[model samples]
Target: MKRLILGIFSIICMVTANSVQAQDKGPEFSKLDVSPMDLAIYRNDKDQPVVRVIYSRPQKRDREVFGKLVPYGKVWRTGANEATEITFYQDMKIADETVKAGTYTLYTIPEEKEWTVILNKKTNTWGAYEYSEKEDIVRIKVPVRKAPNNIEALSMAFEKANNGADLLIGWDDRYVKVPFKTAK
Candidate 1:
């Protein structure tokens, strides 16, 4: 009877030790994403914040990017993985609409001649799958222009303009500039 009790106690201790070892294996991490996230910011000459954008950059990989991989006349997340997000540090005018200082999801409709840039109130969205026109704060049409050079990765940058700054989105051989008139 003592031998039987000892055997049961030893089995329990072994099982507990095995469980601890399993937990000690650490976490299983996922593979790297093909499209990594990126950021773009525009500031006034006074060093005050004007605007900021967070988005993912998808590679071209020698394939036709626009009107094919990314279809025209459809709302794109403006990047990859998660929908692009834009923040207005100050009250700004997009097109004719006045947008208050806040964060918004940025979506776009790519076309051969023009692109419809949208700023929606929705935040923390994964993709354009949840996009709704009702939540849009502003919609502006920006003309598509030929980029001087090819950009293999989806990229965004701000260039100072007369009114404020132009947020340029470039990929492949095409690019678009969205104008923002900021109070700053």
Candidate 2:
């Protein structure tokens, strides 16, 4: 009985040691991208967040962004790793088209002068490998503008407007704004 107890104790000790070693390794580092994960929230005057977006920012890293890394007329995941996701707390009119309140995957088709911003019903996708046009909830064309300065990392922001707000996507030296208004 004593020998059996000793054997069990030894096995437990080995497992504990191995677990400690694994924990010591700490978090894994991401290669190529150093911008970190980020969240953008747009709140109403009452301090309630009406819109939220979760995304991972990828650095330019000296590589050409538009028309190359993200080819023109092709669907882009809009961010690195997992496809960027957006949530609307209430029904809203995007580019004059009504969209129901729900979570969606945001994708884009980059062009030299304009971009097609897409809000797809599908969520939790990796990249644009599984994008489906049939799942799109809204597609809006927005003009691309030159940034006053280079933006190293990909970003999204909501700026207050008359009736609602403008969703801005910026990276490198380009940006596009999509208008949205709350449904009455």
Tell me how many residue pairs clash in candidate 1.
0
Provide the overall lDDT of each model, using Cα atoms, as 2-decimal numbers: 0.93, 0.91
lDDT of 2 by residue, 38-130 (tens): 988899999998888899998899999998888999999998888999999999899778888889999999999999999999999999999
- The candidate maximizing lDDT is 1
Report the number of clashing residue pairs per model.
0, 0
| Candidate 1 lDDT, 3-121, residue by residue in tens | 99999999999999999999899888989789988899998888987999999999999899999989999999999999999999989998888899989999999999999999999
User: Evaluated with TM-score, which candidate comes out highest?
Assistant: 1
> Worst ten-residue run, lDDT, model 1?
175-184
After superposition, the stretches of candidate 2 with alpha carbons farther than 4 Å from their true spots are 1-35
How does residue 27 of candidate 1 score in lDDT? 88
Give the local distance difference test score of model 1: 0.93
